[model samples]
Target: MGHTPADANRDALRAANLRRLLNPASIAFIGGRSIAGAVQRCRDFGFTGDIYLVNPTHAEIDGVRCHASIAGLPSAPDAVFVAVPAVQTVSVVRDLAARGAGGAIAYASGFSEMGGDGTALQATLLETAGEMAVLGPNCYGLLNGLNGSALWPVAHGAARVDEGVAVITQSGNLAYNLSMSSRTVPFAYLVSVGNQAMIDVAQLIDAFLDNRKVRAIGVHLEGLTNVHAFSAAAARALAKGVPIVALKSGVSKLGAQLALSHTSSLAGSDALYDALFKRLGVIRVKDPVSLVETLKFLSLAGVPKNGKLAALATSGGDAGLVADLAETHGIEFPPVTSQGRAALQQVLPAYANIANPLDFTTTPWGNPDAMRVCCDALLSDDPGAAIMILDYPKESTGEHPDCDIAAHAFADSARRYGVTGAIISVFPDLTPPDHAAQMAAVGVAPLQGLSEGIAAIGAAMWYGATRSRILEADSLSALPVLQAGQGTGSSCLYDEWDSKRMLAEYGLTVPASELVPPADAPAAAQRLGFPVCVKVVSEQLPHKTEAGAVALKLDSPQAVAQAVERMTQSVAQYAPEVKVKRILVERMASAPILELIVGVKREDDFGLALVLGSGGVLVELIRDTATLLLPVREEDVRAALLGLKLGPLLTGYRGGRHADLDAVARNIMAIAKFAQAHADRLMELDVNPLLVLEHDAVAVDALIRLDA
Candidate 1:
């Protein structure tokens, strides 16, 4: 369906309001002592626009004449900062919205985050704001370094930049720290989206994408408010060539609990977040340092064309370190071309090793011409990225000119060759800020610390590759909208026979079997085949093996009859309430090359996730699994299958015959289709020990649960 006129009008209005709130021409502060600090921060940041203070108790604040209230202001301000109590905040927002104010930042704490009365109060605040954009009822507010606007209520270390990365964090403290980061990541905007009662991270990302000055976006997420919205915004960023780096916390159970209480957010499954991020082409970083470093590299050097890297260092130890770390981070160092090696041999010392991570041996250390030649030789291979390791002497020593020269030479070489480049320091503090800034000015990232710098390069490469693939395929315009499932109620389980039959209609391969009364079990087994497997078919015996209700490889009628009698006794002992009225007898198949468990898990918020992993009786002991959000394509299923720990076995491991991977993937795709079709009523589904043979794949056992 196409967007309607109402959608267009709403989008336009949102865009306009965001612009006014983010880059306002005039700002108003409404509160007590906190307003003074906010006003001073604006002045300190060189905000040239009008600044109005509204306080009924004070005639003047911070030498600026104060308006009695929002209505008493000289004119409706473009942006207002409300630092009042929760209940009072609603009235203030109502007054501002009535006066046609552009937007307001609610800086109070007691809102939806506190629950109970706070949630109702937050609803009222949202209703009162109406069309006007409201930031949060419990947030630290925003800092626009580009326009020198500080709606934030406290001091921040951000400096104005013409263009840089915009960082939006759920934690106000994290945002504050990012603003004060010494890594010198240029900042266009920093927003702490606490509570996210109104404008969430997705909306902030969308708003940032409209500004060309926002070179990239860095998000520090405790949890996402809306997965589909975030996916759409991320897709837009990918299409626009603006990279997104995410630092996602709350991955652990304890952390998720804390995150829920702190921001009232659902810290959904981390594995699902991984799938979502990968699908959207967003770079996911594990720590703050990596986030800052990755953003710095992307903002300055831009993304590399691929993962191949060419590295240079003055010492062999440094060169070796770079090689080891690069491998660890999955950054490849392609062998230097013969022509490139001949060129490097001409400039370097005779003892120097002619390799990708070439050590120039300090012979041309301070000589700019020779160093540039050395750099050019290394980069002549046309590597996707290049890095020079240079640790500068402390400024107090006054002997870092050679380091600067080397950095400049490498930057020059990278630019000449048209490859992304960075100068990495062995230690975080070794890279002087002045030199770092100079390198950044020349479009070369001056990265601190070897591990983080290499990891940043790896991330950039992944982003580039993923972005290219996504753009080429145009796969992720938006995530599939999850429909509401069946209402919460008791769920009924489909036993093995019924489950297998239901799945067979959807293209799953199941063993040929006959269901008969307990008395006819032996006759049914004889009719099927001599060697057969018999199982007591009952919903109460979902786990037949554990309940001793299953007997495998029964060769004769006598064996089948005796196994059936033992199964009856076992079921009666296991659960006396369950009657063993029926039995399933099926032909026994050959041993499988590998066993796998394919299942669909449904979460209240995240919808269905397809889980692929090693299977059989040791499934839990092995615990090797890969998860993907549903509505997945055939290629997605193939990738997930190949990424598992036992995946190597399917590819002819240790002289073993290769399993038919295509057949396996196709079967899994069938399962995914079935789950999607019954998504509304289906609660859970499991196909364990989906036997993979040399030429075929079959689902030997299955179970399905549906909302009753």
Candidate 2:
């Protein structure tokens, strides 16, 4: 009842109109028994709408009056469910559009979902629909079970969905299977968006976010064609506090190829998606069940402020496994402090572990009070979140009158302290427990294994951290503007001098040096200092060391003259086409503490990016590096620093003092800002051997590239 298309983007808004038609006053079936098999299923599911069958071949079928055409209908139907051959579906939709049908659910293939002539035909059909919305030429259609609206084919089963979560999948069959899965998740809406010829999923997200009845949105995305709109819509959902849990399928290269073949969509890079998720606060899940369950957790209890975990399990082995996994995923397991331990000692037996991830040793099964005591202690200790481990009671074992009571005691203490609580219930087999649904109703997840429970908790904690980062993203630095002819476009053409100027302009310290022609090298060396280095300066010379264009530790007039003559000859022979600009003469640099390589490149999809790795030619072979998106925060920069394989070496290892991390971060930040600001014109930038000397750092070599 909430569909409107007065806006110019009416085709996009048709999904909104389709939502209302999900439960219409009446449904017009144009193909009779072609889809009449679904009549009993629809009526059984409590569809009050009139089923009008229109086919000249049948007078009546399934005890319903048959009409020869939509023009012969007694009154306008809210939606038309059409199932015919690929060729006939178009004509039916065109006629339906002319008849002013609310929307058309085309259960036919051979349109845009296929290539060649079919795509052209689909385009023609979309134009014919005009203001009306078409669900699919190749899709299974949508289910607004909230109001008993089912425009799908009879082949798909019907499930009871009322006041449940809405799922949007790019694949039709997957959406049906996800809804039918025995995961105990009730759904309110399920949309299968194939090809997205008329409307995309991003608009659907926006539509759902507008509906307050929707508790959350689950997206099964194969690709994102319109990134800007998706980001904008996603930001709105996050602001409105409607979390979106997405299970993006195509991340690997092979997966990307498969996705392209499946829907004719482009699957971008994994890194780009990672950056997008971090910025948008989208909770990404590995599988469908996890997607449903995680959204359920967010919907019911909400996320904690911090992810401080206090784990308690009946088995020591289970406790250990949880702790190890939590630690790996960055969930803090702060040990019970002295004060916390003393408080817990008041109520626990002597054998209780007392510390975080406390092992109850199976003795708590006898003493029901002990469970409450441990829960109270942990909650009162004020850990950000906590979980309890229990084995599901079997029917053969009979009902434990005290088990439910004990579970309630633990749950009550958890809620009392305003702490986030979760439970891990392990079942031995596929046998569903009688109380499984009840356990879930109380914020407990019935996990099949301890590993699964740990994984869920880890995901929750990570989501909390990533969301906080997204909300706090107010400090991205402004991008720098790169001038024309900035990048020479040749990998061999080292822009060392220009790059040094760039860094110095950005407030980095640089040693004194001047570019001198080969004829004036002797005088240039004397002017700079007696001890200096002579290096060839040519756009074509990438590695001066390999080409013999570099001669170090020169101390006399004869050495300077000889080095210049030899370099001039070497560069002339090797780089014959490159114009000989000047010979760079600089003072001999002092002893170094560390050397680093700072590189930047404009990725095709994600824009500017930075790479920090080991210095020298070994950088290619050593492969010690860390990559991050541009405009990083101080905390993010420090984290990147710590992530490097050579991180310990920078922390004053082996009597070496700390190598000025603030300065290094500033340098990296400068490159990132430069790349971001000059993305349109800049191609690449590299500062190899950025020497971290005793008290300062200097860019020894620089390279920059341009697009045009």
Best model per lDDT: 1
Q: Rate the local accuracy (lDDT) of all candidates.
A: 0.88, 0.70
Pairs with steric clashes in candidate 2: 22-149, 480-677, 487-705, 487-706, 493-539
| Model 1 per-residue lDDT at 569 | 95
TM-scores vs. true structure, each candidate: 0.97, 0.82
Alpha-carbon lDDT of model 2:
0.70
Q: How many residue pairs clash in each candidate?
A: 0, 5
Error of 1 at 146 (Å): 1.5
The digit string of per-residue lDDT tens for model 2 on 282-345 reads 7788876677667655554456668788787767777887888787767888787776677567
Question: Weakest 10 consecutive residues, lDDT, candidate 1?
Answer: 478-487
lDDT of 1 at 124: 93
- Candidate 1, residues 353-434, lDDT tens digits: the string is 8887988887887899988888888787789999999988877876688887888899989999999999999999988889
Q: Which ten residues in a row have the lowest lDDT in candidate 2?
A: 475-484
Error of 2 at 205 (Å): 2.2
